[model samples]
Target: MTVLVTGANGLIGRALCERLQQKKQAFRAAVRPGVPVQPGCDVAEVGELNQATNWCRALTGVDIVIHLAARVHVMHDKSADPLAVFRTVNVDGTLNLARQAVDAGVKRFVFVSSIKVNGEATKMGRPFTEADAPNPQDAYGQSKCEAEQGLRQIAMDTGIEVVIIRPPLVYGPGVKANFAALMRAVQRGWPLPLGAVHNQRSLVALDNLVDFIITCMTHLQAANQTFLVSDGQDLSTTELVRGMAQAAGVSARLLPVPVWVLQAGAKLLGKGDAVQRLCGNLQVDISKARDLLGWVPPVSVEEGLGRCVRG
Candidate 1:
């Protein structure tokens, strides 16, 4: 019942470590060199994740491998060759680790993927489902799709169990990136004109994601399967902001500005990328996960958002 968690110091990884610790599970945390080791868990530095050497070291005595480590960035990448960089870290690195894990006789390999494999929703009413074909629009999302294909091939060849969990925007205590920025804005009582926007997006609580990950571990039905999971709830931008404000003990005086205005302003100010994210419908349906895993997200959206605001 031993497990190895890559990127254990990350936002979701930290939550997963806490979850495993509470369950009294035997776990090992792996991170790249120079990142601080997670507290209260057995930790190891696997050097460069891209390099195959010493990868076997982390796989030793590991029954389950949760591959969470990958190249991630929050903004439009400045690199001239972002895909090359992403491939080296996300695709090649993933395959290298999986091959090594198979060699180490690991029982299960759980890969945490992004919902962007389906496509970041472009409109409020168009939510992507598991049946939708992968149409990754960005370098990061495309790299994840490539990784999924590579993992599937490796699983087919090695017979090692592979369970892929693709989750949409996940938020909880200590979450960074977009969710953190929203919390900071609300904490300062900064005004946001997003009340008028009705874009619905699916989100996962860190606890729920961790529970789903554990369910995929050694679950006979999860072998060679791909599933999308979320909180089983969708919230509009206005509702999300109001909930966030309430969670942070702030006034819910959200401004109702036009969505086109936001888009126009973002474009005029060279913030079109921001507009794309703020106004998009990055939603996913989780019926497949429900039916296949017989699992349900325990944390409600309100409860999850409250934890983030409190932090």
Candidate 2:
């Protein structure tokens, strides 16, 4: 099957492309203009992912399209209208590509969405499942929810299979943003005030996510289904920090600070949302994926963290 992978230069995209190449899968990489073409792969320069951006060259003769390009969530968004900006790329742009893919005779479209579409966090012991109604808490989440809805509608109208995979906090080698920063902090032996905070969060390794995506590409059970994917291992903030320290062969200097005090400090500094993420319960149940597709995360949490730190 010929697959078209958009956002070929992104963290997940780069890894997915490498895996595809290793497996000898016939695929094309869709990158934005000016980005260097990936050597030894079929590359297409699809400029400016938006409602009007042309995807004809990328979708040509493709059997499947993995839509990974989107306006990812920003912690400190400087846009005047954040929701509108998100909608332009995540909603409008996604639907545009799906519609064009249908015209290109693509049989399946796999969309990589975020767990934020389920909400910022779940209640303790009440992990999010595919049955949960969408409760998007941010502009980026809302846009993804809209895009999913639009894609479903398109699937119904055109008979093209749609598969949606929502992953939570994907991390592994080459990870950046908060996860990477935490690793650096732990490596530097910085004392972290998360010794007492015990909130569970689910994370997916980059390899596991890529493997699941490849499975969905041809798995008949994956069609028309929304799957939540993770490493099936949950960790608290303290445990996560300690694990990083262990991987780096360093001691984690954790301060036993109260969660309420941290919350108060974050609120005072206008970082309440950020702190909540660090000290919140955001877990997803991946039983649907396991039972339906017989898919399992090949890499364990310990191994995934080790690879991340080593990288």
Candidate 3:
């Protein structure tokens, strides 16, 4: 089976392609025009993804298409219409591609969506499940949720299998953004005022997510299903930082600041969203993936963190 992977140079895309290569899977890496092709892979230069982007060249002879490319969440978006900007790519582009894939005889399309589709945060011990109603809080999340809805409609009409995988914070080598900043801070021995915060967050290692994606590529049980994926272990902010420090072989200097004080200070500094991310509960229950696919994360969180820091 020839698999076509979009966003082949991204963090998750890169890892997924590497794993596919190691297994000798027949695959094509679809990258935007001018983006250098990954070495030792069949590549198709599909230009910017949008409602009108032509994907015929990329979809030829492809049995499965893993759609990973999208307009990712931005911290300080300057767009006048954030939702419209996101839909142009995340929703419109996604549905456009799925329609063309169906025409191209692609049997399955696996979309890598975000946990933000569930909501920003979950109450303690009441982790999000696949059956819960969507409560997207941002444009990015809304776009993904809309795309999923459209894909479901297309699946019903076209008989093309659609597998949606919603993963929480995914981290591994080459990770950037907040995870990277946290790693740098820990390595630099910067004292963090999150020692007293107690909140559980779910994260999926790149390897584990890639594994699940590959499984869904052909697993019969995965067709037309949505699954929430994680490392099967939840960590508090304190535990996460300590784990990072341990992985980096450094000492973590975490202050025992009260959660309310931190929240109030964040509000005063216009960093409430950022602080909520640091001190919030956003766990996802992966029992469905476990019970249905019998898939376990091949890499432990400690090992994944070690690879991330040591890389």
Candidate 4:
């Protein structure tokens, strides 16, 4: 079967393509503006997802479309209309491609969604399930929530199977953004006083996530289903950093700084969000994927972190 992967140059996308290549499967990759292409993967660029011209050519002979292109959020965005922009690209653009996929007789549409789409629940220690209420707090998450709604409606109308994978804090080799920063800091041996802080966050390895994508590609149980995936294990912040440092062949210079003090300091510096992320409650329960799909995450948390460090 032929498959199409959007955002093929991205961290997750690249890993997914590598896995698909290993299986000797026929796959096509969609590259958008500002994203580069990897070696050995069939590359196709569509200028804009909203325009009909963009959808017309990309969907030809495409049996499956894994929609990963979206307007990701950033701290540097100064736009007051971030939500509008997110909706345009994520919700509208996503639906445009889905429409084309249905027209092209594509069987499955796998959507990569964020854990934040279900809200940033912190500290109660309860894991979010597929049946949990969607309470997205930010514009980006809201846009993804809307995208899921649109996809669901189209699937019902067109009988195109839609599978949504919600992953939390994905990190691996060649990662960028916050994960890159963490690696840089670990390599530099920053004496962070964060060991005393305790928070459990679910993180997914890139390889395991890619494996999940492959599983969803042919698993009939994935159709019309929403899955929350991780390494199937949760890691605390201190454990994560210490593990990362160890994997990097460095020592974690973590000190015992109380979570309350950190929050107070963040409030004083107007970095409340940063504080929240560092000591926030982000967790998920992937029991459904295990029970229904008979799938297992291929890499352990430590193994994945080790690969990132070695990379």
Q: How high is each candidate's TM-score? A: 0.96, 0.98, 0.99, 0.96
Clashes of each: 0, 0, 0, 0
State the C-alpha lDDT per candidate. Answer: 0.85, 0.94, 0.95, 0.87
lDDT, candidate 2, 173-292, per-residue tens: 889999999999999999999999899999999999999999999999999999999999999999999999999999999999999999999999999988999999999999999999
Ten-residue stretch with the least lDDT total in model 1: 48-57
Q: Give lDDT: candidate 1, residue 50.
A: 75
RMSD of 1: 1.4
Which residue pairs overlap in candidate 3's backbone? none
Considering lDDT, where higher is better, how would the candidates rank from best to worst? 3, 2, 4, 1
* Order of models, best TM-score first: 3, 2, 4, 1
How far off is model 3, as Cα RMSD?
0.7
Top TM-score model? 3
Winner on TM-score between 1 and 3 is 3
Error of 2 at 7 (Å): 0.4
> How far does residue 33 in candidate 3 sit from its true spot (Å)?
1.1
